[model samples]
Target: MAGFHLPLYRTNLIRSSSSPAPSAYTKPTVVTQNLSYWNSIYSDIESHLKKVIPIRDPVSIFEPMHHLTFAPPRTTAPALCVAACEAVGGNREDAIVAASAIHLMHATIYTHDHLLLTDRVGREPESEIPHRFGTNIELLIADGIMPFGFELLAGSAGDNSEKILKVIVEITGAIGSQEMVAGEDGGVGRPAGLLHGCGAACGAIIGGGNVEEIDRLKRFGLYVGKIQGLLSEKSKNEGCEMELLETWRALALKELEYFDSRKVEQISSIVGV
Candidate 1:
């Protein structure tokens, strides 16, 4: 028998094959090096976005607005981002298109969130969430360089845009309902309950009802809510309310891993893997 090696990545990689007899590997043996691939991918896409959108102003909201559309650079190190890029294994340009769309869509929601917050609490016109969030949006949109996310999906996105648009519409509707709005509304201090509810809905969308995914995202949202609740205590020593936001990156990665694995497993099983 040949000696077996452990799976190098943190998640499990299962393979099933049928050939008169069956073959199974407890883990996969693969290694990768250098973050250059993902960096180039993101950079190339960024370049394209710049060409199309073109930056005009310095104190603009476009730049920060762009950040809202994709996973913040803060979530993953260059290396990890590169690894994810490698795993995607698709047309280089298409990757950028998808990623860019993701960023834009996310930013749109953030813009709305700020608007809601601004309206809820009569903060000085400048002290509103819209003002703060708008600043970032301007910076993102006014970039001299193209955003990478636009390139991720590119021309290949097909009907995905429609689906994404639908999701945004639904989320927006939910926010408009009285149920989703509460508290100061403008500042970071939303009613803890509303935040948690929104977070749970987000988890459902991102987690896709997978048990592990749901568990992780729920915990992520719950912890975030707990932290917010603690901070809002406003009396004694309040603790951190940023836990959910802090863990969101980790949860997102995990959710994607589980979602992909389940998909692969389903495919394998259908083929009698």
Candidate 2:
């Protein structure tokens, strides 16, 4: 749910293509009818996720109690993407596969994030987080979970292994210092936005798209990050200093509004609405 994305329209990010204008949004086309293909990919993603994630204590790693409001809205995003793709005559199979992979990737990232924090705060020694030599569980949970996320994304995405590996290498390398510096310096500044953008860039690649695809993915990623920021702040309000709460809320809303606006713009372009 954190943000980092590439622009679909940003040619510099990828080798440009003169591929025919993407099929009309209303054209009746099944780019791929292999429902089985989608299902198989879903199974592959899910199985890999299970292996990496600590399923036994899902809340600690999955949807931890701290992120209640984020779950529903975040879950809706990919569904919206699927519908948008269907309207655009894009293959539902590919769309679903992308959605499944993206969502799984998000979850995987979140799980590692939690582990990193717990380890940081010394809340969960087994987490093996480098910092937080001696802190409480609450403190550990308070931190963001993005670093572990990219690692999992790179290691697990087996379908388009080569492309996934490249994206992982790039995203992971860029995000690492950003995360550590922000954490140590108390500068969670723009984390959600930065994360959202990365998500867009990386997700587009995983979905077999070029720069134009990345643009759409970036907007989508920003929206997700904003939503997460809002909900996470809401969940952490009681524990946060009163002065910080409003600041966090403001950041969340700002991120949300920015993405919401972008979502409209991108969807209009995609659907020719």
Candidate 3:
């Protein structure tokens, strides 16, 4: 797999040494710090995932697995896990391995979903994986990757056995037959909500959050998931969508009331409300 890289921090950091700085020219320390923080999280996740899913002797199988897993960093599931951990005052290192596991599960789901789309030839031609690789092999690869995700969590648990075990159980339940898979068939509403809520709750547990805090964070994730589902629905009415988004956003913020202001801001930034 190619080396991992973070998206460039957009703000320019350079300053002219000779020029007298104006009052308005305050340094973007906060933005810089935030960028650096997330960059480290992304890097850690990539490094750990690469270690768990390495390129090796089985050229065909590993190659496709690598391609799907190491594609462009489009999803925020891993970052959300890291953010949730930090929200509850856990160190990034504690959550990094679990976050990678979450990402692998996500990739597995997507790979399997894409393969299961029977009408891809007609409806999603551009989105189809290369046909040269047989569908059965792809399915097997997806199935195989799922176990490796759990293996990563188990191996990385170290001294935090109880916490990591809880995370594994939570993640497994979230992506199991009743939740994520159900969503694939019935569309997003309750399934998506449950899945994200489960993820956030697991992250909170791994991060050592109190029972109440974990519940609150789970509610926050559920609301965020609902918003996502609503937005994705083609039949959604604009007025109703806005109302639902606002309602969920408010509820999520209410849950963050007890958290530190900095942490609340970071969570809000991740939720984009």
| TM-score (all chains, Cα) for each model | 0.34, 0.38, 0.74
* lDDT tens readout by residue for model 2, 8-97: 121111122223243232222112122232234334434443454443555654444234112212332333334334333344444444
What would the per-residue lDDT of candidate 3 be over residues 1-273, giving only the tens digit for each residue? 112121111111111112223323222112212444445667788888787678876878788787667653344557667778888988877888778878788777766666745654433453445444567876787787778889888987779898888888788777876553334455542255565676678778888999997888878777766655554451223323455656776787788887887875665554443
Pairs with steric clashes in candidate 3: none
| CA displacement after TM-score superposition, residue 50 of candidate 3 (Å) | 2.1
RMSD of each: 14.2, 15.0, 8.8
Models sorted by TM-score, best on top = 3, 2, 1
Off by over 4 Å in 1: 1-42, 55-85, 115-118, 122-238, 241-273
Least accurate 10 contiguous residues by lDDT in model 1: 10-19
How much is the lDDT of residue 99 in candidate 1?
A: 38
